[model samples]
Target: MKRTLALATIVALSLSLGSCRKKNNEPIAPKPNPEKPAPTPGTNPTPGTNPTPTPTPIPAPPTPVNGDNNNTIKPDESPVNATVSIKLTKGARVTIKSDKPLTITGAKLTETQHTYEVTNESGFGIDGDPETLDLSIAQATEFALDKEMPSLKSLKITTEESLKKLSLQGAKNLEQLDIAGAIADEQTLDLSKHSKLRLLALGNRPDMIGKFTTNLGKEYPSINSSNPSTSTSFKEVSLPTSLEVLFLAKAYCALVGADNLPNLRAAYIYTPKAELLGDLSFAGSTNLDRLMLAYTSGGGALNSLTIKNKPHLRDLFLYQMTIKHTSIDGLPTNTLMYKTTNYHLPSIEVHNTPAVKILSLLQIATNLESADLTNNPDLTEEKLVKIAEKLTAVKGVNLKIEADKATDAVKDAFQKIGWTVNK
Candidate 1:
């Protein structure tokens, strides 16, 4: 009865006490380890952990992977900071990300004007995946090609300053590339990797090379004197098999594998100072249509001309050549035009062309050995008379023709030019 009364009294006292705590005697959570710094705001910290005994030192700046001047890029630096990067000598690198109109100043009208411009400009200002790209900055000394531009089919770059190096490894699908004044330091240009490249135009200005003084407060006649030798012209070129049209002005590179290309359609090469050493044999080029060669003011002469198997050749223009051989063999079945001027060959044999409409051999070194036009079915009576009047070198030379297809006037015109008409 006394224990029960005591329990009843304790319950009555606890019920009478307030719910709020008046005072607490429990030891405060042991003061957080004072030596340890507070956890970072977002980081979850272990309650009773120890700090690192020794602090780690910050690493020094990384060294450039290339040479002292940092000319070449590091492998880790493949990610470009911007869409395009341009760096001038001794200047901070600049970046361009805006889709501003980039102009090709001296672009050809016959090639790209119809597709790119209404006036005389070839500009690229598209928002995405532009087909053409022209980055022709005059002051850029180093061009970084870290970003891949896959949709670009045509590219033109012109730099007035010394372009130490250039690699088109970033442009994967280029078709036409024109870099006329971008004088490079490398002696050889290898384009064998560009499998889709079809048209190419490249040249260098000789007078604009080396040091030059500024004029009228502008960077006038910007020069590239990276190589000051007289033989600074390109020594070798590696052309791709897919090349169809080529234009090289002031290019002295040897035509090493140029004739082995089977898809070459047209080639316009002008070299003024170096002799093309190899025989310009186009026997392997079966699809060649037009070939224009002009070599002036050099000892450059054709050692030999071979067109043994070309079937689609149409136009042949040879200027200022000293062809060692007398005959240009294998005039294709579809030849439409053949003209040679300022040549030093003694004779030529043109035969077995049924599609020839124009033939001219002006300013040759000597008269022809014979003029054979026997199988040309396209030489109608009126066309025959016109062709006979233009063959001034046929004077005192025997001319063979299909007499049954020619009119009396066609025969009379050949006889008037001193040609011994042979039926």
Candidate 2:
């Protein structure tokens, strides 16, 4: 019994020791980091959760895709200043918009060649102070001034061909108008309202041989009546009394009588056709200073060139025509004298006047100071001697005769009277 009890005790002790060894081998729970916070539900984690950041986007540049490749700006598209001067070539057009002065000149491809049209599209016209506009074009068939350029003081139109029409209707203050080349046909020009107009120049064209006519309105007078018999009568025609200067070339219309033009200073008429100049009466043009008539051919004997009682008739030039049976009486002694001096007389120039005797013509101009006779094949030495004897009343006279035709006796007769004769 003692040996059995001892063995049981030892078994129990061995089992207890094995249980203690298993309890000591159990694992310990770990502690959390204090530096990091817990993540939210949907958003990303804190910065420490990610290493790299996202980049921002940049925009692209714009492209130029308008107008010509050369990038030249057009004239109309740009702003026009108050005063502008421009020059254009063929096929170019411009619009000048200014309330001030403007001067423009255009040219063609070459100096002699005509090119495409150059136009001005000013709406309000020139409205600047002292308004002045000058336009010179090489060749233009479609050019004009704006209708309401009322303040325009001076206007010059220089072109190869006439504009379709030029109407100075509203240009009241215009003082000078110069048209270089062609003018509009028929009655395209209106000058009745331009009382202040001073200088007017209309150049002649080859095509306008016998087709030109000017109508200065019926308020003044009617030059030509419907009946051909009374066309030369001064009882129907009256002239513009305020007119100062008149010039007509190659125009075949009858002229208004100058008997009423008291202020008339100069008159020039050049007609190539015969019968272009009808009966002319200068009966009362008291202030008349100069008169010139040049004809090509075909006119009846000018029997009505009556320059009676003219006090200021100074210079007279007649070409290619004769004044036969025309009485030029009552020529004033002080006719050609300067306003400050009374010693100087008038100058008479007779060219191609074959039918009219030069000496008989001088009998009317008593105070004649100078005479130029040329191309008179019918002028004989006897007529020249008569002229020399008749001119003896006038002192300090100068005579220029064709040296090839004058005789020594005729030259001596002119030299004996204190006259300077050049043959």
Best by TM-score: 1
Model 2 error, position 216 (Å):
29
Over 4 Å off, model 1: 1-87, 90-130, 139-147, 204-233, 338-340, 346-423
Clashes of each: 0, 2
Error of 1 at 44 (Å): 90
Backbone steric clashes in candidate 2, count: 2
For all candidates in order, the CA lDDT equals 0.48, 0.42
lDDT of 1 by residue, 1-423 (tens): 999999876644443322231222111112122253432233221222233111111111111122112112222232225334444432222211212233222111223222211121111121224455554445444455546766666666655535545556666676666665545545566778888776666653221111111120121111222322212234566778877666665445665668668767666655553355466765567877666565654456666665556666555556566665434445654443323346565444444433233354322334454555666556678877776666564467666777685568877887887777778
lDDT of 2 by residue, 1-423 (tens): 888898776545434422432332111111212233333222221121221111111111111122122212232321122122233334553232222433323311222212213333331122233344444543344444434555565555454433334445556665555444433434335554566553343432121011011221121122222222111111111234455555444333444545656656556555443243456656566767666554444544343465655556544545455443343455433222111111122566654443233453554444566777766666678767766776545568777788875788787777777677776
**Alpha carbon lDDT at 49, candidate 1:** 28
Task: Give the best candidate by lDDT.
Answer: 1
Clashing pairs in 1: none
